[model samples]
Target: MWEAPEAPPRLTVSALTAQIRRQLEGEFREVIVEGELSNFVAHTSGHWYFTLKDAQSQIRCACWKGTNYRIRFRPRNGQQVVCRGKVTVYAPKGEYQLTVEAMAPVGVGEQQLAFEQLKAKLAAEGLLAPERKRPLPLVPRRIGIVTSPTGAAIQDILNVLRRRNDGVSVLLYPAQVEGAEAAASVAAGIRWFSENPDPDFPVDVLIVGRGGGSAEALWAFNTEEVARAIADSTIPVISAVGHEIDFTIADFVADLRAPTPSAAAEMVTARRADLLAEVGSMASALTKVMHIRLLRERQALETLARHPVFDDTQARLRDALQTCDELTLAVQSAVQNRLRFAGWRLERAGNRLRHYPWRPYLQLHEQRVSELTAKLIAGVQAQAAVAQHRLAQALTRLNTLSPLRVLARGYALVQHPDGRLIRTTEDAVPGQDIVIRLSDGRLLGRVAQVLPEPEAKPDPPPHS
Candidate 1:
């Protein structure tokens, strides 16, 4: 009801805009806006002023140096983008503007497309082949870097290398990291470092890349010439381009790929703590090997020391000497016994010689001679007597048993012509010449006068 009274025609242009500015400043403490970028202008004062518009409307935006520094890439016209900022009204112009805190590109990213194209081309050329890659040097004496002289990438690499290993030297081959000739310049730097070897430029490995940038800003790394040069380089290369998510042709052709420049530096050198640990391990292993060898040798020596030849050589010699002594004593004793036996035999022989009597020998000899002479004479006389007696007795027996006696006793002995006495008539043959022996003499006879003696009977037994 009070609004009815025509409030003296409200405020003028300036006053109305000031009221709108106040209202807008309160309403948009923070906001999110999406549109296509246009009229992008970056001032020397480090401020980015641009316009965001669509088919329907447009809004002015500004990013001061402090906030603009956070942007990863430069904003270009025709790029669809999203921004987070606060909407505020300028009281002077009576206009609303956005103070952008952060901004990002919308839709399919442009940098991603460029990265894919470069990667695909390099892969087709066999630059990305696993076989083309070489192993990183185990201990790089010198490391080369190809990057913008003032870029943070070089600083990052230097920092890592210095911190990791102070012994390794770094050679910087400065070149533009962005711009038209950056690719060629970078590729030339790589070739120069590889071909030129001096005490100062004796690079064992090369790190070629820069800090993260948008696709357009990183285009130099995507060139075919750069990839070819990297693939052809004799020095082993490590490609560290952009952030972890970014890829480029140089990365594909390098012998090894690192996600960032810092990582590439780390690969070239070893941490001091890690190297010390490795040295300790090797020393321990060597010590163990030496210990094993020493133990084996000691055992062999002990075994030799315990051998019979080494431990008991003196005892063996002594035993042999004792045996020889015993043998010598036995021989000496045997000789003494033999000498005693011989001396005893000689003494006995001498005693016998001394006791033997010549007189007895002579007496025995004379007695034996006399006895032999007597026995010889007696034997001869006895034999003569016995012979004479035997002859006389034989003469008597002969006379008694002689056939002449028989003949003289009125018996006749008929003898064959051969002078054989015939005892029976059968011994005589008829008409054989014979001799009849008589006591007086023998008479010649002839068997023609046959006279048969009468059969005589056997003698009768004697009567009592």
Candidate 2:
């Protein structure tokens, strides 16, 4: 065939633009592009428009508010990110763009962004207030640990606690400390320990979190639910989330932040050797203080012994002799006065004794007392006899009123087998077992038969 001029493809301007747009959209759909964000603009109409670029190439991207809201952190122009989105074209301008569905910071990952977001939020809510923090118990009776049962974190904490203070008991609330369900499981464990505290196994402090890991591995602690659970916990929570340098949301919300699990255990325990050393130091200081006080007291006694009055022995003896002489003279004067008064008293007593008739009076009083005593004894004996008779009568009446006496009089008490009193025939079913109690014995019986009394017939009415 002869070479012919190529026919120009014929299309209207609108159709051409549409065709190009369809081609671009088909080629760029569902792409994951890695680049630094730039020219970022979040519109009032709830759409994000940005440009993603590396050193070599650039592409326009758009994320609707619905998807943007799901992202954990703000997307800034300088942030390097990997975005997953579908390509679409602005038909009017025929410009190709990406409709981003999800995005994450390239090096930091979504988990890290989530952690920072949660940390910031809880910090703003004052969950991490310094005043809200509680001191770790000096010696926790039981420490509750929430972590992976098989993890090194638990082992490390156990080792530290055991070495520091073996007296404290550790109660494990084994939970997944990483992965998708970690937050919920940790919160559940905290709640369980709180609600069902054991009497003998009560937990005084809670140690929560795992060993050091990547941001994704430690994301469970970043969850708001986990943070709030730690904040709301009644028992003090010591957050041991990661290595010494790592920090998580739980660390801020917790009552105390431990750099590592081992450190948290140390915070809760006291070393035996350290305590003994402190005691020894205090004892030594106390002994020194006592020795100094005793020495000072002895010196004061010696100083008093060396005083002028104690040193002048002969003068002191002479003063004592003079005082004795004065006391003897005073004693003699007092004795002479007392003797004179006694003589006068004895004379008066003798005259009174001679003038009185005490013997006759004493005989008369003795006779009266003897007569009254006889009357009192007779009255008391008579009253006692009357009381005894009344008491005998009361005893007889009480005996007559006794239930045992009624049973002895041939009256039996009927009761259901269950011990309820059976007062009427209706109380016993035809085949029901019953107990009959007599004065000295009980009989268990079953109803063999029941017969009702015949109804009385009414007399015939008078003849009308």
Candidate 3:
């Protein structure tokens, strides 16, 4: 009967699926879908599989590697996304899915998201640590620059370098700084300088950057490949990206960051006026130190001249000479007294002899008196000579003990600023002021450094 309006044109399961797939692909070829991502899987074949779901419904999605390269941010589960793609069905499973051609996050920009993701990854790997950052050279002889040859950045840098220091050499590595191919070009320039260093004109520092622009125009510097190249460079890198307000991934990875290309040039070269100022400052400080030293030395000399030891030495010498003169006078006085007493005795004896009887006896007595007088005179002369010898010896010993004599023999007396003598290393410390007393004058100085005493060897192990 109409019984089977003759199941006219029966179709196989494969044919049914093919018909459905064609219908779905043709109708939703250019559709846009908004949903939350879930169950994302990145296959080894570089194809992405995931589910796009909303509170009310869900659909399967696939993104091939060839098409997903345009997506800037990495996809993750639970992220809301807006996808532009076509709908199709897998014939084998007879299931339907959306083939994603392009995609982006719902609220954030693709570049910003990509930047944050890369930043987090590099930070986790310790590339952003302050300890990893190297210091730029204080005085760069030759500066290497990587930037666009025709852009304003190169002109600004060259002008700054010329103005700051004409002697400093500059080598330019022309590179593309803004576009899809810019990252590789910039990285190649940096690696070229790093790999091929010029011995005759060595590049002391590197500047990699561009002039200010919109975020999209400056996206090349924010790329991970450029960042890694900067980090891997052996030479110190200075990142001079956009204006003061702009920040890029290269800035964080570089050894130093400059607000602008001109600022980087200024940092690498020293101004002539600044150099002269520094030299003048050092000279002024030295002159001041010398002036202070001379004043201290003059004061020290005046102090030594007025010391009590010199006065005491002079007083002792005077006293010794006075005692010698007193001893000489006393010896002469005793000799004179002895002569007078002898003469008196002789007169009395002569009178007694004249009154007494024998003439021969008187003559004999006169001879004896003359002989005794000569002997006593000789004894007094010997005593005076002995006294003179003792006095001369005493004067010589006193002269030998004089402090001035010691100083004249090239010995110096070291003392602290507070007038205490410095006898050992412990009494003086580095940077301490000290006075050195010489024969002619005194010197004022400061201790520069201190060294520890060497450990004494144990007598060579008793000659074992």
Backbone clash pairs for candidate 3 read none
- Taking the tens digit of each residue's C-alpha lDDT, what string does model 2 give over 350-432? 44333233345434644654564455445434533543454345445445555777789899999988888888777777888
| Reference-based TM-score of each model | 0.43, 0.45, 0.45
In candidate 3, clashing pairs total 0
Error of 1 at 44 (Å): 32
Q: Which regions of candidate 3 are displaced past 4 Å? A: 1-106, 270-278, 303-464
Off by over 4 Å in 1: 1-110, 179-181, 194-201, 214-216, 271-280, 296-464
TM-score of 3: 0.45
Q: Give the clashing pairs for model 1.
A: none
* Best-performing candidate as measured by lDDT: 3
lDDT of 2 at 88: 86
Give one clash count per candidate, in the order shown.
0, 0, 0
| Cα lDDT computed for each candidate against the true fold | 0.72, 0.73, 0.78
How close to the true structure is residue 287 of candidate 2, measured as C-alpha lDDT? 42
Q: Global CA lDDT of candidate 1, please?
A: 0.72
